[model samples]
Target chain A: AQSVSQHNHHVILSEAASLELGCNYSYGGTVNLFWYVQYPGQHLQLLLKYFSGDPLVKGIKGFEAEFIKSKFSFNLRKPSVQWSDTAEYFCAVIPLSGNTGKLIFGQGTTLQVKP
Target chain B: SQTIHQWPATLVQPVGSPLSLECTVEGTSNPNLYWYRQAAGRGLQLLFYSVGIGQISSEVPQNLSASRPQDRQFILSSKKLLLSDSGFYLCAWRSGTTGNTIYFGEGSWLTVV
Candidate 1:
């Protein structure tokens, strides 16, 4: 079974602060990783995804994630975050071998940016 | 551009009453559709998915069920609602056959009172 884990439940940061959210997954075989963001009152939007080639994947809104195969981690990072960047971020995993076509998500991290 | 829409932005239903939620996708064909439930402070829990019309897959065994009547339309229903069903329901779609990005709808808030 593929599962995702996010250690940080709530993150508080000031404007222009660097941000990094930890995400880890448990899958023995090939896997696909993704990060999704949800603003208050908005739907979950795809921030980025990693399938095959690049270990470091860049996403929308100046966010990027690196897939560390050995550590089984794909952490979301941003150089500087704005107040508007406050939202809930989720880490998801899809096992390549699973035929279910379903994604397993982490508990999620709530990012609160204070200006 | 592909867009997914879910109806009834918010709903308040009495316990044991019937429930129905609809989701439709536009600008895409034969999309892989999914139904998910989000409880407060919890991750999105996949409930059902469909590869095509009349095809459905259940992920979590619950009081909810899903159906794909059309290529772009997916419906979630429950014969009798339970208090545990109260949460945010989301519909998502993927463009292609395998290994695609999943996009979500605005989501529907259901409160089983």
Candidate 2:
């Protein structure tokens, strides 16, 4: 079974602070990784995705994630975060070998950016 | 541009009541659709998915069921709702011909009392 793990449960940061959320997946084959964010009273939106090629992928809202195959990790990072960045972040993975296109998501990490 | 919509934004249903949640996708054809449930303060759990009309897949054994009556429409239902069924229900879709970047709908909040 494929599963995702996020190390952080909650993180508090002041505005303009650098941010990094750890994500790891358990899969042995080719995998697709993604980071999704759900703001308060908003739907889940795709932050970024890693399908092939570039391991470092940049997404909307100045967010980026790097896929490290060796460690099976795809950690999201932002050089500077604003108060609007507060939301629940989820890490997801889909193993190509399964061919089911089903996504396995992590428990999620809540980020609170204070102004 | 593709978009997915799931409705009744919020619902308060009594236990043992019937449920029918509808989801539809626009601007895409033959897309893969999925139904997921997010319990309070928890991760998204895959409930059902469909590859095409009349095709459905269940990921977890529960009192809920799903159906795909049209190529772009997916429905989740239950004959009798349980208190545990109260949660946030989300509908998502992914391109069948391109990358596997799944997009989620606004989500529906179900509160079973």
Best by DockQ: 2
| Docking verdict class for candidate 1 | medium
Candidate 2, residues A42-105: lDDT per residue as tens digits? 8898999999998999999999999999999999999999999999999998778745777788
lDDT per residue, candidate 2, B1-113, as tens digits?
88898998899999999999999999999988999999978889989988788988898999999999999999999999999999999999988744668989889999999
Local accuracy of candidate 1 as per-residue lDDT tens digits, B1-113: 88888998999999999999999999999887889899997778888988788989898789999889899999999999999999999999886556788888889999999
Model 1 Cα lDDT, one tens digit per residue, A31-58 = 8899999999877889999998989999
Worst 10 residues of 1 chain A by lDDT: A94-103
Give candidate 1's iRMS in Å, 1 decimal: 1.7
lDDT scores for all predictions?
A: 0.91, 0.92
Error of 2 at A68 (Å): 0.4
Superposed by TM-score, candidate 2 places the C-alpha of residue A53 at a distance from the truth, in angstroms, of: 1.0
Interface RMSD of each: 1.7, 1.4
Q: How far is B74's C-alpha from truth in model 2 (Å)?
A: 0.7
The candidate scoring highest on lDDT is 2
Off by over 4 Å in 2: none
